[model samples]
Target: MTILVMGATGAQGGAVARRLVAEGHSVRGFGRSGEVPAGVEPVTGPLEAALDGVSHVSLVLPMLLERAEVDRWVEIVAGSGVRRVVFNTANRIPPAATDVALFESRRAASDALLASGVPTVVLRPPVYLDNLRAPWVAGRLAAERVLSYPLPADLPVAWISHDDLAAATVAALTRDGLEDDVLDIGGPASLTGPQLAAAFGATYEAQDVAAFQEGLTHAFGPEVASVVAATYHWLAKHGGDLYETDPTAAERLGIRFTPVHEWIAA
Candidate 1:
């Protein structure tokens, strides 16, 4: 089957494409610049043009974009005769109760798919573990020798690994009987900011969580600090685990989920 992947050059899409190719499937990746993995075919043009002859599609659209573009993409894909679709959605959206702008946009897209009669699956994943490598974490690791963020010490979070997300996506793409459903993928265990800090400290000789948070503020500014703080605050008050055990993912993918610390080490 020929699968067309949107955002093929990005982290999630790239991992999905690589995994599919490793399993011996033909993949055509659609991207703005038409750049893709070495084994996959890189197709030029917009999402609409890339939909031709595509049996399955994986949508990993950009976040925090205008709603119009999101709607347009969905409209085009729905009309394109693509049978199966996997949409990457956000786990947490702003304003909590109301649909997050980004997730709302994706929900709209999912609606379009349903209205068009295409089989669709939504994958809602939380903040990735690889986010630690971002300037917020890396710069702090380099400069302050501390791991600091606005998130409270005891707040627990399930930080999913990108590799695990990719594996789950592959399972969704290849499996049957998963139409019009939402799957929340999370890490195997939930850990607090201090725990993550401890993990890093164990890895790097002189680093700690205070340094991480400090570095995050330094690299991302106060807005990020506020966001991180809010996330932890909500988690603490909510008192629910972000980590979920998905036997479905494991059964379909034939692999165990990756743990947060193991992913960080990798």
Candidate 2:
């Protein structure tokens, strides 16, 4: 089988592309530049050209793109003879949070893909355990042994990893009988800040909204700060169940994942 993976340079898309390659499927990595992993073709052309002869298309939106652009992608994929499209969201929010732009963007993207009449599988992965390895947190985790973030010290989250999300996406892409399915692919278990720190051999520290926003504003400007701060603030109010693993997809795919500690250590 042949596949085109958008956002292929990112963690999620990168994982998907790599997994497909391991399965011996032809893979194309589509991103803004020519960069891509080994053993995959790189395509940096018009959407139509990228979709050429592609059997399947996988995507993880890099950022908030115009709805019209995504619509066009859907239109092209619908007529391109593509067998399946897997769209993965970084996180999934409750329906009540639709008013928020982040959640609305995902809902809008999902709607377009499903309406395109092309077989599609939407994957909603919660907070990733690999986030702890980010520079802002990883350095501190290594040097000071403290896990810092703008989250409550007690909020439980179902943290997943890139590997787990990719496995599920590949299953949906290769297996039969999963067309038009929206799956919440979470981690093996739910965990809190203190509990998360225990796995990392670190202590937990609260990164207040004020401090978090201030740092982000200085680094990325006010728009990003406001938007990101709002998300963390929202999570602070309503704790992140990112670590709440949903078993529906895993059960269907006949797959299982390592626990939070084991995944992190690996």
Candidate 3:
């Protein structure tokens, strides 16, 4: 039962690939960059060739893909005879459609996958703890000892780490009786901006959405940055809702999320 992992070169997917390999699973890694973890095999040719002999798949779609292109890829994955799929939506689904292209596109892709009757599980992860390592956030924290973010000061977020996310993805893929289920995975604690900064022993500073957007634009081209920034803009308007509300989800899924201090120290 070989598992095919998409975007294995990326942080999230790389973590998953490594964990799966550590567990002694047969892993076939697929990424545009043609890179995979040491134990995993990389696929440099067509996706179908990589899909061969695969029983399950870990799908991680890129954020910059257009709706039509996303639809095309979803169609292909749905047609593939894979037994199950663990799809990382990469963002929390909004209560209703908003102007944020990323959320809408993810929702669309998730709906298509579920509608495909592929016995899929969708994982909606909030802000990644690993994102703190990004130059914009890390630079400020290191040089000025301030943790700056565009989120509201009081808004609580269950920030998740890539390792925790990888563990959740593994459970979603290997566990049974989870077909067609949607999960919102998060860290052990839900923290506000001040609380999160305190964990890092740094001061919390609320950054303007425009400035945050500008920083993102510099990191990941303008198009991807715009959509990501739009999500924060929406969050600024809609506060007090990013944390995980499902109290029993972690215990039920057998996932133990890592703490902020542990993540930061690592």
Q: How many steric clashes does model 1 contain?
A: 14
Best by lDDT: 3
Model 2 residue 45 CA deviation in Å: 2.3
Candidate 1 CA-lDDT value: 0.69
lDDT (tens digit, per residue) of candidate 3 on 120-203:
999998899888888889999999889999888888888998898899999999887889989988887789999999998999
* Residue 178 displacement in candidate 3 (angstroms): 1.2
- Which lDDT tens digits does candidate 1 get at residues 169-204? 887787877787777666666677677677777322
| Per-model TM against the reference | 0.78, 0.91, 0.95
Model 2, C-alpha of 85: deviation from truth (Å): 0.9
Clashes by residue pair, model 3 = none
Model 2: worst 10 consecutive residues (lDDT sum): 93-102
What's model 3's overall lDDT?
Answer: 0.86
Worst 10 residues of 1 by lDDT: 202-211
